[model samples]
Target chain A: MNYRGPGRVRAEEKPMPEILHPEDCIVKVLRSCICGSDLHLYNGNVPDTRVGSTFGHEFVGEVVELGSEVNKLKLGDKVLVPFNIACGKCSFCRQGLYGNCHESNPEATAVGGIFGYSHTAGGYDGGQAEYVRVPYANFGPTVIPEGMDLDDAVMLTDVVPTGYQAAEMGGIQPGDTVVIFGAGPIGIMAAKCSWLFGAGRVIVIDHNEFRLEFVKNYAKCESYNFKSIEDPVQFIKQTTDWLGADVCIDAVGAEAAGSAMQTITGRKTLMQAGSATALFWAINAVKKGGIVSIVGVYGPTGNLVPIGNVLNKGITIRANQASVKRLLPKLIDHVQKGTIKPKALITHRMPLRNVSDAYRIFSDKLDNCIKPILIPPTVKE
Target chain B: MEKIAKGIPDIKDWGIDADPENDPTYPMKPNRTDEEQNGYTWERSVQQAETVEILKSTERPNLSAVFGTSVPPKGLSGAIRRYAYKNSEGQFSHWLPLLIADRVNVVEGIIDDLKKGKVPNIYAEKGFNAMWKYNRKAAIGMIAANVAAVSALGLFLFRGRIFNEGKSVKKALQNYNM
Candidate 1:
C-alpha cells in the first residue's frame, strides 16, 4: 500500500528491490501490520512523507535472499523484523539504545532509521509489499521460534515492544497506580504490561466507545470514554483519592480528538506539528514527581505543551521510539509462557490487496477494528 | 523542594513500597542472574570478500566495513554514479547526476531485460493501472498530453511535405480556374 497523500492508499506492483548493502537482505513479506504510527502519514501529520512511499513498519517475513555479509541469518529463515532499522555497530546500538542508532539514519539526530516512515527516516520503503530490502539485517531480525503464530510474531515487531517500553520507562514502583491515555492497541497493551511492573491499578482513557469496551475486557483494566467523563484529568485525580495517578502515559499523540483547539491548531498543523491533547492531559493528570512515559508517534518538530506545569509539578518525562532489539528476548519468553496473549490483540486479518478498504475501516474506526494485520498475497491461508 | 524531604515524609501515604517483602512487584523485579539480561555474547560477522568493484564516497577515508556485491559498476549509468561517488555527498554535482543516472539506469535495465528475452511490464509496474483506476482525471490528462506531444512531433517531422503540398495546390488553382 502506497501513501497517496492523506486519507488515500493504493496497492501497486513495483520492481523488486536488490541488495543495496552487504548488510541488506531481501525478505519475502509474510505478514505486515498497519501500525497506529501509519495513521500519522495517512492523515498527513508526518512531515516529509512522499506521495509514492509505502507506510508499514511492523512486519515479519522470510529471508528469501541474503547479502554476503549477513552471517546470523540463512536463506529461507523466518524472522520477525523490528521496526527500528539499527546498525548494531553504532554507538547508540552498542549502548542498547537501538532506536537512536547513529549509523542507520545518519541524517537525523533523534530516532534512527525506520522502515516506510518516509524520507525523514532514511527514505526506506516499507514491508507492505511482496518483498522488502532490509538493511542491517544481521542486527534486528530474530528468527521466529517454532509454533509461534504469525499474528503473534508480527505484533512482537512493534506494538508489544513499544507497550513494554512505555511501562518500563515509567519506573513503576510496586503498588503504584498507573493511568494510560488512549485505548488504542499500544495503550491497551501498556495497561496490560503495567501489571507486570507491579501496578496496583490500571486505567485507560479514550473517546472511542468500542475501544474503551474492548480494553476493559482485553486488558482487564478500568476504561472510560473521555467525552462521557467531566474531565479526564479531574477524573484521574478523583479516582486516585484526589492525589492523581502515580504514572501517566500518553499513548495518544498527534491526532488526539478530545480538544478542538488541539485538533485545529496542533494536529492539523495550524500552529504545531500534531495535537498534544493526550500529552497535556497526561502531564496535568499525574501526581507530583510522577513519570509521564510517551511511546505514541509524534512529528520530529515541536508541539504546544505546558512546560511550566511540568516544572511546577516536578514530572519526569520519558519518551522515545521503542528499542525493540533491546527487549525481544524477555517478550518472547512472555509469549511462550502465555503470560501475554499478543495474538488476541489482532481483530482484523486482511490480505494486502484489500489494504485500501482496510485503511478506511481502520481510519474511520468502522466495524470495531482494534488492530488490522495485513497478510501479503504470497502467504497461504 | 523542602530540603529533599528531610530523609522521610510524615505524610499518611509515606514510606510505601519501602519494604521488599510487601512490594507487589517483588516477583516481577529484574533478576540480574537471568542469562538473557546479563552481558550477552555476540560475534561480529566475518567481512564479506569483495569480488566485485565497489564505489566509496570521497568524504570517507575507507570503504564501509561491508558493501553491496549486487549491481557493481559496469554500464554507462554506472559510470555516472561512479563519478558521483568521487565528489562529496553535500554537493549538487554529486546528487543531481545521480537522480538523472537512476532514470538512465532504468532504460539500461529495460534494454538488458530485452537482451535476456524478458519483456518488462512498464505500464503496470509504473502505476498507470492504479492511476487510471483510482484517479481517472489525472490518467486522462496524462494520455491527452502524450497524444498531443506525439502529434506535434509527427507534424514537425513532416512539415516540409505538408507546406509544399499546400503551396502546389494553391499554384495549380491559380492556373486552372482564373
Candidate 2:
C-alpha cells in the first residue's frame, strides 16, 4: 500500500528493492501489522511523510537474499526485523540503545531509523508488500525459532517489546497500584505485563466502552470508562486512598480525546504537534514522587503539558522508542512458555489489497477491532 | 587478588561474565561478534585490493579495515548523495536530499532493468495470481465495489443527457411532483 496523503492509501506496483548497502538483505514478507503508530503517518501527523511512501513498522519475513557482508543469516531464514534500523557500530548501539542509533536516522537528533515511517525515520519503505529491503540485517533481524506462530512472531517485532518496555519503565513494585491511561493494544499489553513485575492492581482507563471491556477480560485487570466519569484524576485519587495511584502510564499519545482545549490546540489547529490530554491526566493522576512511563508516539514539536505539577510532585518520567533488539531474548521465552499470548490481541486479518478498507475499519474502530494484520501476497496458504 | 577478599566470600553473580561467551550483545549485534572485548584483542582486518570507488564516512579519519565493492558515486542521485555526505549526517540538509535521491535511484534502476530486456510482470507480481488462488472472495468484493462506484459516477455525470422529458435534476424532480 502506498500513501497518497492523509486518509488516502492505494495499492500499487513498484520495482523490487535490491541490496544498496553491504549490510542489507531482501526479505519476503510473511506477515505485517498496521501499528497504532502507523495511524500517525496515515493522519499526516508525521512530517515529511512523502506521497509515495509505504507505512508499516511491524513485520516478520523470510530472508530470500543476502548482501555481501551478511553472514549472520542465510537464505530461507525466517526472522522478525525490528522497526529501528540500527547500524550496530554506533555509540548508542554499543550501549544497547538501538532506538537512538546515530548512523541510521541521523536526519536529526534523538530518533533512529524506522521502516515504513516518514523521512524523519530514515525513509525506508515498509513491509506492507510482498518484499522489503532490510538494512543492518546483522543487527536487526532475529531468526524466529521453530514452532512459533506467525501472528505471535509479528507482534514480537513491535507490539510485545513496546508494551513490555512501557511496563518495565514504570518500575512497578510489589503492592503498587498502577493506572494506565489507554486501552489500546499497547496499553492492554502493558496492563498484562505489569503483573509480571508484582503490581497489586491494574486499572485501564479509556473512553471507548468496547476497548474497556476488552482490556478487562484480556489483561484480566480492572477497567474504567472515562466518558462516564466526571474527572479521571479525581476518580483515581478517590480509589487510591486520596493520594493518587502509585504509577501512571500514557499510551494515548498526542491524539487523546479527553480535553477540548487539547483537541483544538494540539490536534485541530496544529498549533502544537499533538494533543497532550493523556500527558496532562497522567502527570496529575500519579502520587507524589511516583513514576510516569510513556511509550506513545508524539510529534517533535512541544505541547501544553503541566510541567509545574510534574516538578512539584517530583515525578520521574521515562519515555522512548522500544528497543526490540535488546528485549527479544526475554520476550521470545515468554511467548514460547505460554505466559504472554501476543496473538490473542489480533481481531482482524485481511489480504494486502484490502488495506484501504482495513485502514478505514481500524481508524474508525469499526467492529471492535483491536489489531489488524496484513497478509502479503507472496505467502502460500 | 585474594588478599583483598581474605575476609569476604566469593559470590556466583559477581564474576559470572568472566567467560567471553557469556556476553549478551553479540547474539543480537551479529556485526560485532568478532569485536575485541575490552579492547584487549584488537586486530585490523586484511584490506581489499579492489580499486572500486568507495564512499566512506567523512567522520572517519581514514579508510576502513575492509570495504565492499558497491557501485561508486556516478549517477545524478549518486552525485547528490556525495554532496550530502559533505555535511554531517545529523544535518537535515544531509538526509532530505538523500531521501529524494533514493526515489531517483529507483527510476534509474528501472531504466537499467528495461535496457537489459527485463520487464516486471504487473498482473502476476501485483498479486492477481494470489487473488485467483487464495482470495477469490476479496477479489469479487473489490470488483463489485469498483463497478458500483463507476455506475454511481456515470449516472451523476450523464444525468442531464439520459433523461428524456426531464433533462436537469431540478426538472426531473419537478416532473415527479409531490
Choose the strongest candidate by DockQ: 2
| C-alpha positional error of residue A96 in candidate 2 after TM-score superposition, expressed in Å | 1.3
Model 1, B1-178: lDDT tens digits are 2242243213222222133343222112232234334433333334444566655556545433333233455577678767765666556565555544544655675677589796755444334544565567766986898799999999999999999999999999999998
Off by over 4 Å in 1: B1-178
Candidate 2 Cα misplacement greater than 4 A, ranges: B1-178
Worst 10-residue stretch by lDDT in candidate 1 chain A?
Answer: A102-111
**DockQ category of candidate 2:** incorrect
> Clashes in model 1: which pairs?
A267-A275
| lDDT score at residue B57, model 1, on the 0-100 scale | 52
Over A1-381, each residue of candidate 1 has an lDDT whose tens digit, in order, gives 765545667676767878767788999999999888888877766644545677788999999999878899999999999998877864446667778765554223455778888644655789888898888888889999999988899999999999988887777765778899988899988988877766667889998998999888877778999999969999999999998889999998887889989898875543566898999999999999888898877775567788899999998888888889888998888888787888888898888987876776676566688899888889897
| Total clashing pairs for each candidate | 1, 0
Residue B122 error, candidate 2, Å:
22
lDDT of each: 0.75, 0.74
Q: Say which candidate scores most in TM-score.
A: 2
